[model samples]
Target chain A: MGKRVGIEVSIAIADAVKLARADVIAAYPITPQTHIVEHLSEIVANGELDAEFITVESEHAAMSCCCGSSAAGARTYTATSSQGLALMSEILYHPGPMRLPIVMTVANRALAAPISIWNDHQDIMAQRDIGWIQTFAENGQEAVDLTLHAFRVAEDRKVSLPMIVNIDGFTLSHVIEPIVIPDQEEVDAYLPAFKPRVRLDVKKPVTMGPVGIPEVYTEAKMAHNEAIKASKRVILQGWKEFAEIFGREYNPVETYRSEDAEVLLVTMGSISETAMSAVDAMRDKGASVGLVRIRLWRPFPGPEFRKAAGKASVLAVIDRCLPPGAVCGPVGAELRSLFYKMPGAPKIFSFVAGLGGRDVTVERFEEIVDKARAYAKKRPTELYEVIGVREI
Target chain B: MAQIDAIVGWKDLPFGCHVYEPGSTAKFRTGDWRSQRPVLDKEKCIKCGMCWVFCPDMCYSQTEEGYFEANMEYCKGCGICAHECPKDAITMVPEED
Candidate 1:
């Protein structure tokens, strides 16, 4: 094992950008996410990383610049969070459909009503259907590792879906931890420079984003769907390759103490750490429980998730945001579709928790599990349960 | 009016407005002209008037709630209404040639 060193998550991301040898970077400043671009800017300015770092007026333009650069066959990167991400939501779907492998770092932050700048999954969760490969890192080290691997996974010919690597705002982005800075020679050997077979080459004119008629419109969407489905194999392959080089492990879905447990708790992002401690406490008290963390949200690992939650009597899904008038958060809705036909698939209990950066303590996780256990005993009434709210 | 002998040389038409030789490249291929007409879901439409306003050839009639029936006589099946419908109530599917 390598000796551990303390480093902030922002610097870790900058170091990953350097290792990835990103050809072009364009970003706008936003809280929590700002430090990452700032560090990258300094690196570019100091001539440490030879890349075109363009500062744009807004997040939408930032993404637009990425689209142009990636289309020109460059390894592109960017960072944003919260309102910045929401602002760029439209263009986010365009790059993937065009099959440009642009990697981005989103410092996960809470959405606004009054306004907030704290850590939450609401921003990235809202972008679930944007056709991007999404991953959540629990800490700074994972953030750097995943960000580097995202480029490799995305540019793979089998899976040309763009990827978003998410680290919690302030929590992971500003925090420090030991990150193994991979040697440039090693990274160059691991992640070869992007050489697109198809690009916007003026020598050979080809159409892109053309208005397709009925004869071809559905075909375009179907192609994108199939490409994403194909990405599953690419993700596993990328993980295997990354492990071979770095000796670090990664999976689409991660389980902690999940074996021989009747009850399982599901969550994502930074809250998994909290959930783990809660599961440990519950186990110490002789409770039959475990935790399953969903690392990849998009290209949702339905089959893998089913295998992970095998034979559990009750599956409690915890989400950080509400879908308002819907049965549960988006994650719960996606999970429910996976087991609609299976017999004895276990009763799924959806719980909404940790909105607007609220503290999700160990006691709260246990309370959610207890409520879910009670509900599973009765006839299923509703598909969702709102946790940690005072009902009048 | 003077002497209606024969309407020849009109076969060089492009949009069926004229006539031309069968094998000529300038002649229209009727096979390519057939395409799907746009269908509107009136129930989900919110009187946005976007479809009517955005029709490139003004083929859509403005109804009180939304655009009225598409005029197939002039409708080229361009699908501008389908693309511009913000509510996604308009759909275009293939029609028999």
Candidate 2:
């Protein structure tokens, strides 16, 4: 393993992009996510990384510039948080259908109405169906590793899809952790220089993102769908190679001590670490408890997730983001769909917790496991419950 | 107007629907939408090329006699050519004429 050093997660991600040798980075400043671009701008200014740093006006322009740069055969990158991501969402859909392999680091934050600058999955959840290959990082190490993994899978000739690495804002982004920054030669050995299959060259003069008429729109969309689905093979392949190179492993649906557990805690992002500790505590007390964290969000690892959670009788699914007036939280809803009508399927108990930088402590996770076990015997009144919401 | 020749299955479609063929735009003959056509009078034309320059769709092309004529295949009957004619040499005639 490489020498580990204590560094801020956001800064570590910036360093990861630098190691990827991205050709272009265009971004706007937003909270939690600002540190990443700030560090990157300095890297560009200091000439440590030979890359174009475009200080764009808005997140919209940041993404549009990414599309343009990627189309022109530049290895493009960008980063943003909640409102910034919401603003750039229209252009966000373009890169997917346009097949631009631009990588972005999203510092997941709560969306505003009452206004908040804190950590949550709501920001990324809003863009769930945008057709980008999305991944959630459980810690700073995963954040750094996933950033590099994103560039590799996204730029792969078979994939060529945009990717978003989601790190919970403030919770994961602001914290300083001991991270092993990979060597330049190691990164080079793992990820080769970008070879764009198609590019905007005057000699070629090919049209890109052209107006797809009704006759061709469905076909075009179908092709994009197939391409994204096929990308999973390459995604896994990249991760396998990454594990071989770095001696660190990653999976779509990662499990911890879930072999014979009756109750499983399902979580994503930084909260998974806390959930793990909770599971350990429960196991010490002789309770059957385990943890399953979702690493890949888009092109969701259905088979892997099903296999991991199949043995458990009850699932205490935790969602950091709550979509109002839904049957359950997004992750809850997805899990329901996964196990729906399956024989001997686990009973899912959805819990909404840790919204807008709220702490999802070990005690809260223990409570979820107990509640999931209690509720599995009988259906709860409400489909999903919001934990720690004091009605005052 | 003919639709894009995209009747093939999803697998046959290009990645991201990127049109790699050169001059692919030439396939869409937009002139079918033209309700009125530009009728040019060779006698009054001074060969000033105003119609060609003023054409929004690049529909006007100069003939061997130096008279600018609207290519009906791509012309959208915008009437800019007739309106911009310095000598009033062009008239917007309905397609029936």
Query: Considering every candidate listed, which one attains the maximal lDDT?
Result: 2
**Candidate 1, superposed: residue stretches over 4 Å from native:** A1-3, A379-381, B1-97
* Runs off by more than 4 Å, candidate 2: B5-7, B29-97
Shift in Å, residue A209, candidate 1: 1.3
Tens-place lDDT per residue, model 2, A169-199, is 9888999999999998888998988898899
* Top DockQ prediction, candidate number: 2
Report the lDDT of model 2 for residue A275.
87
Candidate 1 residue B42 C-alpha distance from true site, Å: 42
lDDT per model vs. reference? 0.82, 0.91
lDDT of 1 at A295: 89
**lDDT of model 2 at residue A153?**
98
> Alpha carbon lDDT of residue A47, candidate 1?
96
* Candidate 1 similarity to native, TM-score: 0.80
In order of appearance, the predictions have TM-scores of 0.80, 0.89
